[model samples]
Target: MNMRRNDVNDLQVKVIPSTINPSSAELKCQSSCRLPDRSSFIWYKNGQKIQDETSSTYEGNFSPADSSSCALKGFEHHPAPSVCVHGQSCNRVIYTDRSICASRGSSVDISCTYSSDESITSSFWFSPDRSHQWQNPSQPEDLSKDSQYAGRVQLLETEKGRSTLRISDLRESDSAQYHFTFKTQSFEWRSSLPGTTLTVTALQVQVIPITVHQSHMEAELKCLSSCSPAGRISYVWFKNGQKMMKEETSLYSGQFNPGDNISCALKGHEDYRSPSVYAPKLPSVSVSPSAEIIEGSSVNLTCSSDANPAANYTWYKENEDSPKASGQIFTITDVRPEHSGNYYCEAQNKIGSHNSTLHLIVVTDPGTAITIAAGVTAAVLLLIIILSVFLWMRKKRASNQSSEAEERPDNRERTQPEQDNLHYASVQFSNNQADPLYSNIRSDQLHRHMEEQEVIEYAAVNFNRAGTAPRTRGQETGEDPSALYSTVNKTL
Candidate 1:
């Protein structure tokens, strides 16, 4: 056993070993100060602290060419000086965390506490998995000096025998097992393999639908990363880019209204949140061929919108009460004038809905327009010609009827002279809007035809026997008082 009374601040400590040789042994401690519990006692070696090793006794071995010391927790500055005890080499390390998980692009702290039984000459951190490819290299290169870690690695010595390797802007390639190395005046510290393992991953948000309804949605969101989470990891959530309060967990279950955007991040790395998921945005519509569409030509309409959940599209015409088609694209087989109008598209999702700008569809008239117009003109001309022919035929028939009446034989016998003096005249009138002859007919035209069914009874002419009267056809035939018959009683 080795003991020393290197009193510092009148606080002395002694280490008692079960064996006096240079090998593993049981040791105990007694302090000159008031003895509290053993857990409050602090152990030291080679004028440096063995962090977290707080016991009145160190129940282990020592290096064959090294030394150790002890003190109370609060009296560490007054530690009892160390004594050389030959047992074995002094090269041991204890990490604050065996494994750590961090998000990519974020910083991380990989810390540890180490002890050596000899005076430390140099200390640095390294990664064995990324070391040089040479066979059995002496030791791995310092991480801070490596080109891959330049300007982003920070080597910190928080205190004697304690170190922290902070890496900024971490990447997946930086993931590996890290170790701490040190050199003494006589020998280099042998590293304990697998010092601290770092796992770098990108944050992602995954949604699983729990319940779906019309007004609202219930879903469970999980913040996921490739790195295996250790222990109780805390998580943070955001809604519409604003921080939201919830219990610390990787999974979140809640009701979301329409148009809500969600994201997540590790509690300590909230700056590196996952991408946001949301409903549809304002939609846009486009027409194929991009020029004027003609009748009978095929045209396609496409609707597009940005959304987390793929949006469904619907096409509708203005002033119409129904939707024309559904899907991202709407096709018209043969475009016609009926298909020409103002149209718009709707992009919808479970969360919300959006509409596109109105577009006017104009189906141009084809080359057949001139032919159709010519056909209509021909039909009108034929109708006019037929009306003119019908009027001519009616006029000829009326003239023939008058001639027959003149040729009809009278039933009563007439004196030969009276028959020669009798002369008769007949006329006919027609009702037609377009006939100029019908418009000029006089009202006293011997019981004119007033309707489709009318009878002209007779026409009688009276002859006066006065001397001063104008001469009639009968007077020219002979000097006698005769009857010029024109007495007609026409009944309708």
Candidate 2:
């Protein structure tokens, strides 16, 4: 008789007890049983009834009306007890679905479980917020719920005990809460947990940087992340996957403001160590734009060496020491022809150094003064030629005039009467030709004859031009013509 009472109590709580802990037992019973209306199921212990029993099964102190007892007559196991599961919202016979958003084109799962020990034969779902009721909705529903979830709603292929609903071809309209209804052999009830809600969102992607332009004076390197409610996050810089010692930028020309771009140096080991986070270490260097220089002019060189901590700059002359030229302009005020050579600048930092060479070719042309000198030389040579020609012609004319003057004789005049010769006889003969020194002749007559002959040969005076006359024609009858001519020639 006592044993029968224990057996009856065992039948009241139907779940099999786990051997691991006999005290802790699960309540497993039909999830769809109906109770006698107005007369609730009573829990009995030792042939006595208990009211409002909450335990799933009795492990110790069996007695009716004991709060520790797990016995209820005419009522199977149900999950509506107020002690709610952690992280869950409510503890009710039916729970509202909460898991909403899902990826597009993917299957959406709506999970539900009825908190009752009654055997669930079938389960159905209804589109909440839409005025529609389901009569055996698992089979077919009214046009309102049917038309809305028509091609997208269906029962899952799992066993009915799982009571899970899966909807395919989910669109944006299917994002509302759903109601799940459970059916058993004796009664029907909704799930204590609400149907799972689904919110389909577009597939989100990340924004990544590809390449940065070198010409940019200042630029940022960005690693775009999926747009989430959480704004911009922090970034970690890396070099060859090694985390950088520092995080901020100092040498960069631009600031790395929130969501803004970043810049870094690139003059190290000839390689780049990409950053781990979304932001990349933009290994960049500030390079001065190429400049123009006159062949003979000088200019100072300037360049920037890219680096994380920023690099120092050094000026050089073809890899030589930088001259003490102020500023970046290597000015040579009095630049000479020999002050020409190759020039360049170097920028350096703790990481490394960068250098570029610029060939300085000084330009020049012949000066105006030199050109003027050459022109003067040619003009003077031409003038000398003209003067030499003129002088030569003048000298030739003067020589001819002097020669004519020497060849011509001066004019002379002779005016006297002529006389007849007196008569005289004297004869002498010598057998031998006597020397003219021993011979004695008329001295005056001999001398006169010689003079006459000389005058006739030498005289050709321009008497017409001088206004004079011939002396020989003027001799008288008493004088010999030879003697008179001789005397006139000798006297003239």
Candidate 3:
């Protein structure tokens, strides 16, 4: 049976007696693994077999073109990768990863590998100052001794040609180019050319306005960081605490309502999430008295909406283009009939805007209304007065007739002998001679007696036409009617 050597383990070579001076530098190759006593070794330089001597070590003078590695005699297929010394001191340092990005308040590790022809005594990592050189330090200063990196920086590991520097609680000031340095017995070395660059950043969300209408608004949101992160990165979207279906894209677009909260983050970096942004929603309008909107009354209309940032309010009429009022509460003092119409309010924010509608109705004032009522009442009163007067006149006439009937004698009384009828009878009276009855009477008494005699004659004629008994000359002579007739004839 054949036995296979453990070729998978790494192999290293170092120079003995150090290369301090190029002119007298003698390089000897030695391996880290232990071989059997007196075992022979194979040596190669830059992938070409240079010696196959039956010794465990190779000795030669250092040369600028020489790079060396070794393997067990028969296991040459697993020879170590090449290593070379460039400077006279044969001291060199290198970083495997040249650049890195880390979130603020996070931890990071910078790895490097270095080699030297002499034994390493010290190793540390540092950032250069404005002079592009290492700052002043104490005799044995390392990264942990620096005031700026005191407790936050540490050397995690160090092996032959390998070192790792760890930094925690990263801040933006930590972003800079870093170089690794180490000291051997006689030489100090620092990595040259490209060094590890760190970028410390915090996530931020940017909201871009697209379009806005009365009902809704459209906007685009993007996840942003200070510098691009290393490796594959994915984005996550959230709305009102709920995860959204959209992923893998930095740009997001949708209609937003007022008070809607939106946020984004990297899939693996939820701790450094962007701040929440609130989108504007449509407005709602309400009136003090929703129904029976009246004119000539004080009224108030309120507009409200939810949004990330507080919203501005503007009130407008149906036909007007310019806003009539501005604020959450729109007030109309002493409203008029013309104020009754369709009205709407606009609520706006940086992200979006919306509008709501309301209707108003105005009525007549109390003073004018009372005037109309008084006019109607006066017309009714005037009609009542006129009707009352007409009724009073008709009643007065009836009363006068009743009084006349009571004063006049009935037909039976007229026909009785106690009542005497006076009539104006024609009697011959010469101007030269007066009657004896008139000769004794005064002129005033004669005039009054003639008036009385005429009224009696009218009464007798009315009675005679009303079917009462008429008196003959003989019957009237018995009651002295001849005397009254003679007296009336004398007056005529």
Candidate 4:
């Protein structure tokens, strides 16, 4: 007698004889047996049942040549059993060991086994706590979550008789243990022990500096990734797939921040990017003493800017073949019509560049130009008018002095007597032309005129003594008897 252990509602016993002796097999009675609380028995031999069997232990016999044996089957079906085995109809008792799992940027496979050879029609996989139902056997082709598996999930079909589930796109979030279930004929699935904890990791390569100014001389870019405690992180920068030697970070001293952030600075690589660096705009330019140019004339031009890197100047001639000249002065030795056009200059540095334009035109020598001619004509006209006014003023002053002399009573009295005496002297001198006293005749008229007035008389005496007595007199004063006697007495 063999006792079968069961956890479900059923208790069973099987009797397999150690040796079969004859056509009829009989058994001696066992006095005591441990049976179920509520049990029934059935005895069968060669697909046939015995006619009567009531006692737990029986001694019965049979004839030979029948090829028969007696079998006793006791089943306690009041409560359901917990363990399902072959030829046993009870709830299944599934068991599996705990598991540990891990993966990288890809998928992971978790496996479980059963205790019995039960036929399974389907399978399912879920996360810890069974909150997330990952997959069902009927629909296993969906891979939207394939990214979570890192693109490398595969189910194992042939294994140690276990239902294994493979998950792809393993991320950090997929680090928990998973549960699995296998469906049997009754559409019932028993869960396996929670599988191993899957540790999903990845090697990341990210560009640190995301933005930069155009035509930046030098730009520093960093690439970093999350690494295992045992793994090392490496970085290299690529431009259009061509690696930059200066952009390498092998000698960098700093590591990624706790949250995986890093940065670097680039310098002195002016041509690293395209176009040009961003800088302040160029300053407006102007020229002083603006002139319409002529041959052999000089002009000055100035350049300025609002830039950080100080602006350099270069002159550009538009529609002309003149060689470029720097600085402010452009001396045109012999300017021609061809030298006339639009001219500009470029002021620039690493910061920025700007352009200013000026128009040049050809004309005659400014010294001898028509405009100068007009200015000279006006100046000459003004000088002539000033000279004419000056001469007119001088003549008017002479005329005014003559009129003033005629209008002054004191000086005019002396002038009228002098005039009358001059008339009388002229008559006397004309009458006595043949005599030596012709000069004395005019002086006698002045003496006769002076004798008529005391002031003139004194003046005559003084003038005769000084030998300057005017010949305008009618007669000599000394020839007068009265005057001669007075002079002699005075001399006495």
lDDT of 4 by residue, 305-423 (tens): 55433556778788656647875454455567777777787775543356778777767666655576678889999999999999999999999998988789878787877656523
Report the CA-based lDDT of candidate 4 relative to the real structure.
0.44
**Comparing 2 and 4 by lDDT, which wins?**
4
* C-alpha lDDT of candidate 2 relative to the true structure: 0.40
Could you tell me the lDDT of residue 486 within candidate 2? Answer: 51
Better of 3 and 4 by TM-score: 3
lDDT of each: 0.67, 0.40, 0.66, 0.44
Candidate 1: Cα lDDT at 373:
60
Best by lDDT: 1
> Which lDDT tens digits does candidate 2 get at residues 408-488?
643111211111222222222222423112222335774475455443322212112223532322231355645533553
Write down the RMSD of all candidates, one decimal each: 27.8, 34.0, 30.4, 36.8
Q: Which ten residues in a row have the lowest lDDT in candidate 4?
A: 77-86
Error of 3 at 36 (Å): 59
Cα lDDT tens digits, model 3, 1-492, are: 232444312445665544566533333444454545665667765335667864656666656534556665665544444456334334455456656888665678898777667688877877754223335432323566677787898786756678888998777788887777777776665332335778888766687878876656688888777767666667888888888975667778888765578878777555556677775477888998654545657889999987655788999999989999999999988888899899999887767677889888665766565666678889999999999999999999999999888867775576554236454332333234332223233356655765754444321111122345455443445756556555455454
Cα lDDT, model 4, residue 192: 28
- Deviation (Å) of 136 in candidate 2: 14
Superposed by TM-score, candidate 1 places the C-alpha of residue 424 at a distance from the truth, in angstroms, of 99
Candidate 4 or 3, higher lDDT: 3
Give the alpha carbon lDDT tens digit for every residue of 1-492 in model 1: 223333233443444555555466544456554454444666655545664456666766665655565665654434443444444344555567656887776788999877676688888898877767424466667778888899999988879888999998788898888878788787665542346778898887777777877777898888888776656778889999988886568888888876799888877777778877777888888898565466778888899999766788989988988999999888987787788778889887655677885564544665455555667789999999999999999999999998878766543334344434432333222222221121222355533432222432433333345677555544567734322232222311
